[model samples]
Target chain A: MALPVHASPLERIWHYAYLVICALIFVFLVAPILVVIPLSFNAEPYFTFTDKMLSLDPAGYSLRWYDSLLTFGMLAPDAPRDGAWYADMWRNAAWVKAAKNSIIVGFWATLLATVLGTLAALGLSRPDMPWRRAIMAILISPMIVPIIIIATGMFFFYSNPCSILGFECGRLTSTYTGIVLAHTILGIPFVIITVTATLVGFDQSLNRAAASLGASPRRTFFRITLPLILPGVISGALFAFVTSFDEVVAVLFLAGADQQTIPRQMWNGIREQISPAILAVATILVVISIGLLTTVELLRRRSERLRGMTPR
Target chain B: MADLTAAAPLTTADGRPLKEALARAQRRAKTRAFLLVAPLLLFVIVSFVIPIAQMLHRSVYHDGFSANAPAVSAWFAANPPGTPPDEAAFAALAEDFRAMKAAKTAGEAGTRVNYTLPESRSLFTKTARDADRLAPPYRDAFLAVDPKWADPEVWQAMRSSSSAYTSDFYLSATDFRHTADGGIERVEPRQRIYVYLYIKTFVLSGVITLLCLILAFPVAHLLATLPMAKANLLMILVLLPFWTSLLVRTTSWMVLLQGQGVVNETLLSLGLITDSGRLRLINNQTGTIIVMTHVLLPFMILPLYSVMRVIPPSYVRAARSLGASSWTAFRRVYLPLTLPGIGAGALLVFILAVGYYITPALVGGADGQLFSNMIQFHMSKSNWSLAAALSAMLLAGVLLLYWLYDRLIGIDNLKLG
Candidate 1:
């Protein structure tokens, strides 16, 4: 806020000092994220910036770290950048496999969470919904409870997946289905919250009007409700996807070698070796999240507009 | 009765009783709503709820001794507490030992008892192998095999272990044990790490929460008081971190905070310290606190900003006009108005921090490990029972805070940006 016109110089000084403090806080928030981008380009293995780098020497910086992420696990590092090379990189490179698995898991988990969570949100957002408060609490608990606890619980439960039914349905632990299932539970809360928030501004009278015009419930949802809430649904799906993609604890517990995700690979890398390849991955993830964040923000603004909620 | 009641019932426009018609319609609506939610409710129950319930059940479901050592278990059941082991008890023990030896199950059985009584695992295995050669007057024979058989503590453990369902895991979780005389007693002080970790978890979480609130208050206040466009631009600073992968942020902290890294390098060049005197910021509690505070700051800022935005600035101005100083006006008017936000943000951060695993696992050295790290240790040891007990305790605290958060600032108000 602008300082009030006052006689004392102290108040104006404090106002300028306050602005400076805010600037520092913003720097604190952004500095770490920016620091990694430069480090990932360092020619040397060290994390520190070289003296040459500070002197504006181009030789101090290179794309080797990013390139290493590709060729580290490749069968032939010196080969031409051909289709076979890319295919081999995908097959052999640990990070590439992790990226692939992350996409696969993120997609499936998002699909499951969005469908189930959206339907449930529709029900919970209804005026006539029963036990609404309690159900909302239960559905959102996966977000509040610690990941370690959830991972441990899933470890025990997935280890003996068939014991409850008194049959040998085999173990879920270390399986793709198990990891996807755990991620789905973890992702549901975001989906429910976003979709339900969207549903809150929805008008029930539209559904009534559609029904009065003889449209079926399913038809009315597609024509009147689904299109209107599409932005919310997409945003929720993005959230669910990110939750699954960023998650490592569940992958650590539920998934095996076959289901390794990017975060899990990073966990191993950071624990065993703090290489610049991880910095490369971190930089890439930051860029991806920037893209996702922009999409969600745009979708949110569109949703508000569709709902006619412009600022008064 | 139906005919008589139907004749006198309040009628509707469609000729059905109004009460019946309304009740039927309401019932149908409830069913429809429930039907829409049932699939997800069931999915969550199977995926999340049931697993947690099963894990908690392990706290009382240790059946190792009772299930394996049937003979010893039976003798413990037959004799009363504080009973001296005589011939029959010794004979049952001898028989059980022989049976365990043949089945090669003595190791598993020993591990179970050793969970409570340390260094007794080898005793069971050693005694089991020698049980076949021991003579009668079974007490002396058993004593000759292993002197621990005569110790009252062994018998006490046996008696307690007779039941398949026992609170031994919970007792061990709290660093307590059931004594031979059936009285509870504290464990050896050296072995009491879980309780220490739990307390440290609480204290650290509180410190983190307080730090977050202190740091977040000013930023949130600025965001609230600024113009919408400026605030929205600044809001990206908060939201970017919120949306970034947690591992990425933690790795960035590692890159910056490690010794010989940017922070230390900057300090060294600035004549802040000698090369040998560079601070050990990484892989320790300091690193943990700093990184976690950064990561969780958004959680604190968002809720506080949301609450602070709605608080009218005129409240402070009105107080100032009444001749109060700026500090006094802020304290009485602005600060009081932001209490709910503080509660929400503080509780949210505290809950998340208390259960933190990954950050501490990465940056936290041996000394910096939190309660979740200990739980991870127990889990890796295949000590699922102990882990479950620890998890149950952690879960209780989180659920309580969660309920409080819901009660004070409803879950519907939880926002990401």
Candidate 2:
């Protein structure tokens, strides 16, 4: 709200103080995250800036921490820089392997979540869908429930998925399949939320018109509905991917040593050794999140525009 | 025409009855819609709901004792509680001890009973190891191995655990233990943890929720009142942290708040405090609160901003014009109007904060741990029953709030960016 000209001096002073307070809060919100980026490059194995860094000396900055990300688990970390060294890093570096596992699990989990969640969102958004509220709650309850509870439950159930059925089977724990299944459950709510948000602005009449024009339901979805909602679906998919990518508790409970994702590795790194390498990883992850956030924002604006709604 | 149609159901042009056709079509549409959602629904139920239900079952049931000591369990079943150590009971214990020794499950049985009767696990294993030396006077024989066998409380524990299921874990979770007389009593003062942690979890969560609101309100108001473009740009300040990885945020906090970290360093150079007076910020209660508030602040701001943005600034103007001071106008008009947002944000943050594990686990040292950390501890220790019980309690509290949330805010209105 704009300050009125008739406002008293105390009111004007309070307004200025309020703005300053808001600015400080904003700094509190953002400064900690922004603080890590520069510190990640500190020449020393320290969490703070050195005098050289304060003075803007080139010697104060180093890529050693980022370099350690590649060389930490490499079998021949000290080998000369060559093709074999790069291959060793790709194959054996702890962070690289963890990143690979994260991508694999995130990709499969997002795929499954997007497909199943989109279908459910479409159904839930329909007027004739039965038991809509109850079903919607069940679908998204994973998000509301604490990750520890969900992880604990999955830890027990996945260990013996058939235990409740009075039978024995192979355990799902410590397996990629189990991790993917858990991540999918965690990601499904985001997909449902984003996709259904888009569906809210959908014009069902277009689908009806396509049907009246003798287009089959599948044909109509592929041709008319899919094109209009692709942005939403993609947005939902990205959300699901991010959810899977960022998940750690489930990985901690369900993953084996071989299934270490980036978060899992970072968790171990943080707990066992608070190295600058972790800060380096955190910086890279921060950049990735910024990119993802920007992408989602763009997609959201495009979705609004495609639906013929004015962008906020 | 009406009379004719009443006698013969209304027919389409092709002479088919329209009523049956329409009913069948409607049924098909309903089925189709259900089929679309069926896969995900089933997936969630199997992967999510059933596992939680199974965990709840574990909370009340552990078969470690019942499955191993079949003869003793059966004897306890035939006899009622408060039954003294009769000859038959001692003989059954001897028999089960022999079986346990053979099956190498004395440790298992004792572990189960130890959950209720502390230190009895060693007695079970110790007696089971020397079962071969037992004589016909079984009561004396068992007592000779360990005088604790004469304690009725041990018998009560075994009796309660006689079946494959028992509520002992739940009882213990609420800080009560079974007495020798077959009644529940609070555990020793020194041993009580779960209830204290629960209260602390809620109180701390309440405090954190309040802190988040205080920090968030001004920013949310600023953002909501600002022009759209500037608000969106400033919103990045909020969204970046929201989008950043949780572990990263936690790590950054650790860096900033650690004793030798930036904050302390700055404070030290400024003479804010002497070297020895450096704040014990990380790995304590204050660290837990600060990190959690920062993490959950976005949750509060988004909802408050959304609500304030649509409040039709005229409401406050109306109040101001009616001889109300700016402060009075805000208090009377703006504050009350934002109540819904306050309630939603507070409940959401509290619910989330109550269940927070990773943040408190990482930043919270010994005294800073929450209820969820206790759950994680039990899980890691392979104490599945206790973990499940603690989880069930946490889940109950969460579900109640969730129900409150659904009733108040409507789950459909739950939004994320």
lDDT (Cα atoms) of all candidates against the true structure = 0.89, 0.92
Q: What is the lDDT of residue A292 in candidate 1?
A: 92
- lDDT tens digits, residue span B35-64, model 2: 999999999999999999998898888899
Q: Report the CAPRI category for model 1.
A: medium
For model 2, how does the per-residue alpha-carbon lDDT over A1-312 read when each residue is reduced to its tens digit?
A: 689889899999999999999999999999999999999999999998899999999999999999999999899999999999999999999999999999999999999999999999989988889899889888978988989999999998999999889999999999999999999999899888888889989999999999999999999999998888888899889888888888899999999999999999999999997999999999999999999989888888888899999777
Where is model 2 more than 4 Å wrong at Cα? B1-20
User: How far in Å is the alpha carbon of B151 misplaced in model 2?
Assistant: 2.1
For all the models shown, what interface RMSD does each have?
A: 1.2, 1.0
lDDT score of residue A305 within candidate 2: 92
lDDT of each residue in B1-417, candidate 1, tens digit only: 889876787789779978889999998999899999999999999989999898889878887778779987888877778888888888888888888888888887777787777677899889878868977888889878777788888888777877878888889999998787889999889988889889998998888888888788889999999998888888888889988999999999999998878999999999998899999998888988989999999999999999999998899889988999888998888898999999889988998998999999999998788988888999998888888899999999899999998999999888777
Q: Could you tell me every candidate's TM-score relative to the true structure? A: 0.96, 0.97
Clashing pairs in 1: none
- Fnat, 2 decimals, each candidate: 0.75, 0.78
Considering summed lDDT, which 10 consecutive residues are worst modelled in model 1 chain B?
B111-120
